[model samples]
Target: MPTLIRPFGALLLLLLLCPLAFAQPLPGVIASLAERAPWSDPLEALGTLSADESVTLSATVTKTVAEINFADGEQVERGRLLIRLEDGEEQALLRAAEALSAERANVLGRVSQLQDRNLAARADVEDRQAQLDQARAQAQAQQARLANYRIRAPFSGRVGFREVSVGTLVTPGTALVTLDKLDVMKLDFSVPEVFLGRLSPGLALSATSVAFPDEVFSGEIATLGTRIDPVTRNIEVRALIDNPGLRLRPGLLMEVIVQQRLRDTVVVPEAALEPSGDRHYVMVVHEEGDDHRLEQRSVMIGERRHGEVEVLEGLDEGELVVVHGLQLARDGLAVRLLGVMDDHTGVREILEAHR
Candidate 1:
């Protein structure tokens, strides 16, 4: 029994000694000191680009299309004639009404002259004047009916592809074309109710799209939804972006970020975080008497932007945290400083690798 116990003790001692033998200062491990800086938390959300004003042009009355005055995809001014329907019959009727109105006016003039000469009854002159007024009203009504055959642009915008051509019969409410005011773009996005205080009219924001990865569009908040959506607990936000170059289009998907007021906070590289289950930790290096040692510290993280993260708790300014070679880090183990993480490009390269 004593011989067996001695062998087991030796085996246990060897297992313990093996870890000590392998323990050494981890080389090439990048480390950086945390610093307090102005941090502006950005809210990320998906957004959609829309036209400041958009509509599908349609006819208000059934008529045969006689002429198309504007070309497809043309930029038109307000009140420009776009479609002209068959108004020949209406024009003829208007001409007849005008002729009748002219005859009534002549009769009214003669009646008034006769009344002045004491050769007509006052009642006769009054009756003639009434007839003249009715004739003029009838002519005006006919002229208005003739104007209905022409469809004009309601606002200044770029026209879309027309669905109808000349001589096509269109019914009331038939879509003729689409018109969009493209000088300014409207971006619609939503944010959680928790961010309500941060959202307001005139707030600035930046947006990006997959189509234009290098370009960042800027805009200002134009409006906000009156109430929060019960299902999502989010409020809708609308922003207006100027499209001077006509680069942005309606319905484009965009990633939007709204900048908030800045506050002083501790910031660190994202690579330094070691996520374990629901908790997060970072390998921290501390000076103990004559030796520098590694320690694992749990931290409460806040917002993340670019390649950096805001540490809300468990860290202070000027404390070094391991950023690279974290696998080699162990609590209470001695470690060597490879270099400051900021001195080398490793942190940036690591952050951009997945991007």
Candidate 2:
């Protein structure tokens, strides 16, 4: 009986050691080093473009159009004569006023000479002076009235299509053309009230238009609405963009992206994140001699942009995180370092290159 018991004890010891001898080898995984990078979560909204200055030109008096100096859609300077009405009558009246003014000056000069020589009464000299002043005032009035017959540009801008042709009789307030200063464009958009705290004048923004698909227009916040819209819970924002090329026009729809504040933070590939319920975790790989050991760490994450996740806590720059073969990773699990991933390379590329 003693010999049988010894043999059974030896067999039990062999069974216990067999499991350890046949254990599976550690798994292999791809990892990436966490690094610091500038990051910002941009805010997006739709906006409309408008000229820096805009106006509609119209006739201020009833007159027949004698000459239209500007062509349709012409660029004009300030005070440039744009149209001339039938001014023959005004010209004749101005000539007559000038002649009368000349005659009054000549009579006043003779009367002043006579008064100095005591050949004329002092009252006569004073009366002649008053008549000369009145004649000059009348001439000045006629000159002003003559100016009303010509239409001139109010400011430097691009003019729209002409609404009336020469010989067309225009009444007061008759529409003539539209003018806009297009050197700078004003972009207006709305943002939710929740983002109001983040917005301020001079904040940079970029805009894109379907009309110019390949071009990106840049600008900054110029002003903010004084009051928020209670019904929509939004606030209006205006940005000024330099439109040197005059490509942007009024009433153009564009997509706007407001550049938020940038921050430097540790980031890792999104593939390395292990989400469970509302919590997130990453398997951090620690180098142990020639082998690597993974420690499942809970990390506080902030923003996720592109394929990278911003690690707010529990991660540091220069640390390695498992990105591929995460399904085989766990706390305290041993892993083989297959390869490293980088910002410019994908996981599949790294894995295939290692193979």
Candidate 3:
């Protein structure tokens, strides 16, 4: 009886020790502290670029081009002479008018002196004055005609390729070249009429171009259309972007994003969310004495951006949430905290470094 009792006690002791020896260790997970960050709803649209100021230069009269003062793609100043046409006839007429005007002035002065000495009649003095006035009028007319032979830049800007060269005959309204002010660019885009209430001058926006995939351009709204299109139900918006480097050109297509409705809210990593049907859940690390346990909590999420989610409810600032090894996380389960992730570091980097 003593041998049987000893064997049974030993078997019972082995059974209890086996369960403890085979117990699994706590699961490891990476967590991040929930923090408040600035959040905004973004509105996206496509935009077309244009120069702040643009025009095509043309000739005002029919004449042969005598001199081309600007080269293709040349920077010119306002009122700079760009083209000179053959003006020999106009110049000759102006010279003749000037000579006649001088002769008339001499006659008028002589007649006035004679009238003061009682040697000439008053009618003679009046006739001389009228002749001088007529001659001066003719000279002024000739000068006005001569100005049509020259073409000058209307504004300071870059000139496009020349369409005509020296000795080429050009008629009135013939296009000579294109001039554009490229120091600033104008971006035009349309937004739905529903956003008209939110649209205003001085609103901030960002733009990107396929031609420059790595570059982002910043700008602000300059104007909003007064009326919305009845057919399209959209309104036009214009933005101004500085182009100090002259990298942007007219007619380039760009993608634009407008920042709207900004607020500061509690946020967490998107990876920490576990979707259960229509509800989202997160494993929050709760401290109990010296041990850390996970508490499964449902969260109300709002806007999502850049791998981060805005937590509208069921979360608080400075609370730790699991971001990695989520499969091992469970309510009331003990977890080994591997590390904490920051705004810049990734979970894979933290895990590799921990190992």
Candidate 4:
């Protein structure tokens, strides 16, 4: 029993003498410090691209379409005839009315001359003038009726695909076509009220369409809605883009990039951010006497650019941040600095790999 106790005591003494290593302080890569420098202005929400103007063409009266002057999907100019109905009777009436108007004018002129010669009542000249005016108004009405038989373009734009054809009956309420003016385009998007202060009119913006993945359309903030939507707690924003070639169409799905929102921020690689629960963090490296060490710090992040994040707070300029192996890190742990993560070898490199 004494011999057994001696061996057990000896083993316990050896264990007590051993100076255990505390898990090598969790390995991580050090990211070299970037002086708190001015970063690009950040953007928060997206926008869409729409037509600058969408005009709905409508008829003024009920009539059977005699001829569709413009073909489907036609580009029309202002005042150009787009459709025509049977107008023989209306045209004839207009001509007769014009003749009557000319006769009334002649009578008025004769009455005026007689008044000058003291051969006519002042009332008679006035009556003749009124008759002439009525005749002219009748002629104008007939002219408008004739014009109604033809549908004319109100503005220069591209006509949407038509659902009507020759001989099809239509009315004043029927939608003929949609004429969209896309020389300059518009974008309508929404943002939370929290970003209300960040949004400013005339800020530069860019958008990309899924249909054309390779293209990016640039634009500017045109206007903002006066009220917020109660259901979404969001406010609507409008952006105007120049579609010089008329390539973009209405109802296009897009991804928008609004610029120049944030004044100054520090941009860092996304890998350096360590998120836990509701907060985010980044490990900072420091020296202790003769040993290198790590310290965990909370960070306030702002906008994200590609694979980098904007550090809003909890970090100073010219501080080393940990970018890799943060899952095994702790506060004030002794660390060995092999090398530092850099623009070429750190988060920037990770983002390029994904891209």
lDDT for model 3, please: 0.93
lDDT of 4 at 79: 93
In order of appearance, the predictions have TM-scores of 0.66, 0.75, 0.83, 0.66
Better of 1 and 3 by lDDT: 3
Candidates ranked by lDDT: 3, 2, 1, 4
Tens-place lDDT per residue, model 1, 1-355, is 9989999999899988798776654454668889898888787899999998999988777889999988888999999998898888989999999999999999989999999999999999999989989999999999888878888888998998999988899888899989999999999999999999987888778899998999898898899999999999999999998887677889999999887765899999988999999989998888788667888999999988888999999999999999877887888878766567564566666556534
Between candidates 2 and 3, the one scoring higher on lDDT is 3
Can you list the residue pairs that collide in candidate 1?
none
Between prediction 1 and prediction 4, which has the larger lDDT? 1
Error of 4 at 354 (Å): 26
lDDT by residue for model 3 over 103-151, one digit each (tens)? 9999999999999999999999999999999999999999999989988
Candidate 2 local lDDT, 1-355, one digit each (tens):
9989999999899979797776887788999999999887789999998989899988877999999999887899999999999999889989998999899899989989988999999999889889989989999999998888888888899999999999999998999889999999999999999999888899888899999999998999999999999999999999999986787889999999997776798989898999999999999999999888999999999988778899999999999999989988989999998888875877788777767
**Which 10-residue span in candidate 4 carries the lowest summed lDDT?**
21-30
Q: Where is model 2 more than 4 Å wrong at Cα?
A: 1-41, 118-126, 260-272, 282-296, 317-355
Candidate 4 residue-wise lDDT, 102-160, digit = tens: 99999999999999999999999999999999999999998877888888888889998
lDDT of model 1, residue 165:
86
